[model samples]
Target: MARIKDVAAQAGVSVATVSRVLNDNPSVTEETRNRVHDAMAALNYRPNAVARSLRTEATRTLGLIIGDILNPFFSELARAVEDEAREAGYTVIMGNADERPDQQDHYVRTLMEQRVDGLLICPTAEVTPLVEEVSLGERPLVFLDRTLSGVEVPSVRADGSTAIAELVAHLRGLGHRRIAFVSGPSTLSTGRERTEAFLRAAAEHGLEVPEEYVRVGDFRAGSGRRITAELLDLAEPPQAIFLGDNLMTLGALDEVRERGLDIPGDVALASFDDVPWFNHINPRITAISQPTAELGRRAVRLILDALHGRPTDSVVLPATLVVRESCGETGPGKEDGS
Candidate 1:
């Protein structure tokens, strides 16, 4: 499909010029407008949701940009947001950033051009300038799951420090001394925060977490598998390996299965995000459960409240540790998976 850039090229103008024309901006010369229209006709270009809400001063539509559609956590969060928006009689347009900062910026700009009543984003760590602009702009903007320090936007995020501490304590009690971690990329706030929380918890428990014990993954199954393999190859491998995200846990499990390693019996496993499937896995995986659906619901409420001239504040929800057999709790009559 042809994009805005193609229209700009055919019209011999910048993409911004095409956007202005589409929005019917009064600043554009009549000649330029004619050229843009001619280009559109020649190329059969179709404009996306553009400026329909300008006159009414409201689109009754909310834009939601997510980090990754493939992540089950984000998927559940999106569903909650959509449900809340639907109940409020507002439509939601979703954009998947796929964890790319540039892609995120693109969606933000496009949604603005579409004149969405508000925006909800699970921002990347890069902190694109456009996001800052939206926060400062007249429109209502809210950050979902992640927010930057200086952005000044209301956010709904989950705190997992307590859960991480509890998980560390559980592992220590299970007689697991050396525990390694597979973390997500540093380009996201969740990735950094979870790892920091784990480190703090490890230190509090008197367990040393060296640089080698921390491997960075891209929050994908492939990275989880590769990092787990690298960690397991160490001369003195860790007694347990904790995955920083749900998808990473899937990858780690694949590696363990291919190598014929038993859960908890070989190397104990844990995860940051708890999904439904985790419970079904043999020797159910121990995990930290985040308020994902609540985050989404709270984010929508914040945006709606702001748009309605009501007060709004950033919401921080808690995560809890869910212990299962994957980490192998030791007790009488237990199979000793730990």
Candidate 2:
């Protein structure tokens, strides 16, 4: 097999310059890059990835830990991250934590062992000791969607406060006074933030939310279905229901269908993390539309920036309300620009 020395000799350049070309380092002039490429092609030389990674102390790989793989939002976000990472010349290793803190820790340890260049995590409710340790370490870390307070890591997530408020106002305009929210685990930042936003929005409109009206779920479809069933069973059921995420929205829809209740008739429905399928489904769901793909792109950029010794800052994208028939889009709430 042709070696680096042979390519270097053939290209009439030093081995170090050949190595720079192999690494695609821009410092190598265009003429030198072309010469190195031609030499490699003529000699049929293929650089050793393992040796390069060992020498450089960089794997050109990123670890991504998502909350749940089954959730459409997470799945889509993973796809976007992968696409952007590939374009940036890095491979991505994804871990499905399934919203379990223990599982998340397992991936963290495993990825660190693999020596990934950086990590992008959508954290669970509880931060494990391992997680805390890694955050304090020198590795570049970026939070995806969910964040932990005082962690000091940069994050890429959406601000849904305005969208949640608009949703509540839309419900109120449709005459939905007794509304309910099916939320995710309280341990995660998203669950807590969404709940707080909902409460604040409700209070602003003089709507009283009983303690029972707030139900916490596992951010999965099953939890959504279970919570929806329970909510519908109340003696005085909520006139409208707002689910925290798309997977929960699916479960809520399943429960609604099983009970033969019509959306916007028996119980109006709205959800956060609008997925593509939401628009295709019958009656169409009302949702808080986030820049899901952009969130993924930004997460990769932030982590890469950190890896490159560049300054990094947290990015918060905006979430907007998309009015649809599921929430009975009455004209009163239209003024909020939903």
| TM-score of candidate 1 on Cα atoms, chains taken together | 0.82
The lDDT of each candidate is: 0.86, 0.86
* Residue 150 local lDDT, model 1: 68
Highest TM-score: give the candidate number.
1
Native RMSD of candidate 2 (Å)? 13.0
Our model 1 lands, by Cα RMSD against the true structure, at 7.6
Residue 296, candidate 1: alpha-carbon lDDT: 91
RMSD of each: 7.6, 13.0
lDDT by residue (131-217, candidate 2, tens digit) is 654664556789999898756688899999999998888888778999999988788799999999999999999999999899999
Candidate 2: Cα lDDT at 264: 88
